[model samples]
Target: MKKIICLVIAYGLVFTPLSILFSCTVEAKIVSASSVLSRQQAIDFVKKAQKNQWTLTEKDYFSLSKVKSTMNPYFTSAYINEFVNVGGKNTKSGWISNLRDTDDVTGYLPYDTPGKEMTVSYSKDKKKIYVTGYANSEGDIYKVTTTLVKTKVGWRIEAIKWL
Candidate 1:
C-alpha cells in the first residue's frame, strides 16, 4: 500500500506540471489575428505618434494606464515593472522609457517626421507586424517590428523592435 501511494504521488507530480505546460502552450498558439493590422492603420498610428499626440488623442492611444491594464501576463516581469514604473529623465532607462520619449512606439522614424510614407507587413502566422519607414535626411529606411497581443479588451501593443 505504501509503495502504491508513493507511485501515485510521483505520477501526480510529474503529470500535473506537464498538463499545465501543455495548456499554456496551446493558449500561446492562439495569437493569430482575425483582423490583420492594415497599412492604413499603421500609417495613422504612426502619424499620431509623430505628431506627439498618440497619448493625447482620444481616438488613437488607449492611454498609458489603459495600455498598462491591457498588457498580457506573459510579458516579462522586469519589462512590466519598468513599463509601469518609469520616471523622469534622470533614472528612466529602458524600452518603456524610450517608448515614452519617442512619438512612435517603434521609435521615432523619418516617415513619421518627414511624412515620407511607409510600408506595413505581417507575419505568416499574423502574430507579428512590421512597418518600414522611408528614407530620412540620413537616408535610412527604418524597419520596425511591433508585436501586438490579443487580450480580453481586444489587442494591445506589447513589444517593439526597430531594426
Candidate 2:
C-alpha cells in the first residue's frame, strides 16, 4: 500500500540519520581519548618503572618490597612476590609493569555531550590525587579509579577501585 511505503520511508529518514549521528559520536570518543602522558609524568613514570623493572628482573626481592611499600593498600605485600615471580618467569603479567607502555590511555574521561576527559583531581588537603578512566558510553560503562597519596617516599597509589 502507498501508506505503508510512505511510513517505511519516513521511518527510514528519521532512523538513518539518528543511527549515523550515534555512530559518529562513539567514534569521536575513541579518537578523543587521552592516549599520551605529559612529559614530566612520563619521565617520572619511566624512572619508577625502570627502577622497579631492573630490581625485579634481577630478582632483588628486598628492593622490590621497598618499591611496593609506596603503593596503594589494595596492593598487599603478597603482590610484590607475585610480581617478582611473574617477571622472573617471563610471562605477560610482567608486561603490566612496563612503564614505556604507560601513555595517554592512562588518562581517560567519560565521553559526553560536552566531551571532557577528567584526568586528575586533588583532594582538599592536596595530599590525595584521584584519576578516573572509563568508556564514555550510555550503556555498560566500566570505570576505574586510582587514588594516590603523597608520602615521604613520594606520591604512591593508595587505592584502585573498579566501579
Candidate 3:
C-alpha cells in the first residue's frame, strides 16, 4: 500500500506541472497566430490603398496605426502613402492649383496579395514575427520583421525592419 501511494504522488508531481507548461505554450502559440493574422490584415489594407480602393475612415486609420509605429518613423508615412497620389497640374504657367487626391496612377502597385505566397515565422517566445513574400505587381520579394509586446489594447507592434 505504501509503495503504491508513494508512486502515485510522485507521478502526479511530475506530470502536473508539465501539463501546465504545455498549456501555457499552446496559449502562446494562439496569441502569436492572432498577431500574424492582424499583420496580414494591415498589409492588405495598404494594398487596397495602393489601388485607390481604400476607404479612409477612423477605423481604417487606427488599424494602419497599429503597424505604423513599428516601421521607421522617418519613412513610414511615405512608404505607405506611396499608394496615394496628389493631383495637380505641372504646366509652364507657374503650375496650377494643388489638390490632394487618391487615384490609380498608370504604374500603381498593390502592396500585398493573398495568393502571392508568404511565409510567416515567429520566435519561440512569441514576441517577434517575420513575414517574407513577393509583390505580385513588381515580382520583387521583400521581408518585414516586427516585434510585438502585450498591451492593454492587445498586441501592439514595437519595431519593424524592411529588407
Top-scoring candidate (TM-score)? 1
TM-score versus the correct structure, for each prediction: 0.39, 0.33, 0.31
Q: What is every candidate's alpha-carbon RMSD to the true fold? A: 13.9, 19.6, 13.8
Model 1, range 61-146, lDDT digits (tens) per residue?
24454434433323333344444443212232212333445443332223333465566777788755565664333456555544
The superposed Cα distance between candidate 1 and the true structure at residue 22, in angstroms, equals: 48
Considering TM-score, which of the candidate structures 1 and 3 is the better prediction for this target?
A: 1
Total backbone collisions for each predicted model: 0, 3, 0
TM-score of 1: 0.39
Ranking by TM-score: 1, 2, 3
Q: Give the winner by lDDT.
A: 1
The runs of at least 3 residues in candidate 2 whose Cα sits more than 4 Å from the true structure, single-residue gaps closed, are 1-118, 135-140
Q: After superposing candidate 3, which stretches have Cα over 4 Å from the reference?
A: 1-110, 136-139
Query: Model 3 residue 88 lDDT?
Result: 27
Candidate 1 residue-wise lDDT at 52: 44
